[model samples]
Target: MTAGGARRGNTRFVVAGLFVAFVLAGFVSGYASSHPDGLEKVAEEKGFLGQADDHAFANWPLADYAVSGIGNERLAGGVAGVIGVSIAFVVGGLLVFGAVRLRSRGPGRASAPTGDRGPDDPGPGGPGGVGTDAAGAGAAPAA
Candidate 1:
């Protein structure tokens, strides 16, 4: 891999590690703010707590960030948190995968071969393509 590629991979790793650390800290410390969180606090201060109606899924599994029917609050909360993280990770991975797949192809075209080419190669912004100097005034300079 090029230095830039390696650097980007390392940066991603660091970010992922930090995310894991933060989630673990939240789970272990149970050190959330004692103050009422945003919506709850606003409702209380504005005397609009009654404005909020019970959600349709109020009794649904995973409601209130706890597993349904779990006897232990702490364990239920932890399991719910882990499930949330897992869902987030899967969704994020699928999004990135789809984006990469889409960008690997031209509009209505098959995926391109992943290859290194000279700077003169005619890509989407190359001399004859859209955003090329010959085609537009604000075209980007060739790399």
Candidate 2:
């Protein structure tokens, strides 16, 4: 693989690792905020708290970070936390996958192969060789 490909692969791995770490951290140590955050505080102050719509899944099989009707709260919370983490990881992975695919095309593409020319060597086709004319630039030349 080319250096650029290797770098992109490494970046993907690093991002995947970070996603796993974030999920594990949230699961092992609970993630509930002790105080209401900025949005919640603003809602309370604005007296529009009643404007909130009840989520159909508010009392879902897993709600409020605890599996509903579970005998053990801690176990239920941990299971729910892990489920949340997995969902986040899957979503992040899908986004990254889409970005990579999208970036693999077009003129400003990052993963394009770079010709190996010495500092003194004239690039591809020499001085007048294979200039990046519109047609030449857009064509995907054979590997």
The whole-model lDDT of each prediction reads 0.64, 0.63
Most accurate candidate by TM-score: 1
Q: Against the hidden true structure, what lDDT does model 1 obtain?
A: 0.64
Q: Which ten residues in a row have the lowest lDDT in candidate 2?
A: 121-130
- Which residue runs does candidate 1 get wrong by more than 4 Å? 1-26, 106-143
Worst 10 residues of 1 by lDDT: 134-143
Off by over 4 Å in 2: 1-28, 106-143
TM-score of each: 0.56, 0.52
- lDDT score for residue 66 of model 1: 80
User: Looking at candidate 2, what is the lDDT of residue 100?
Assistant: 54
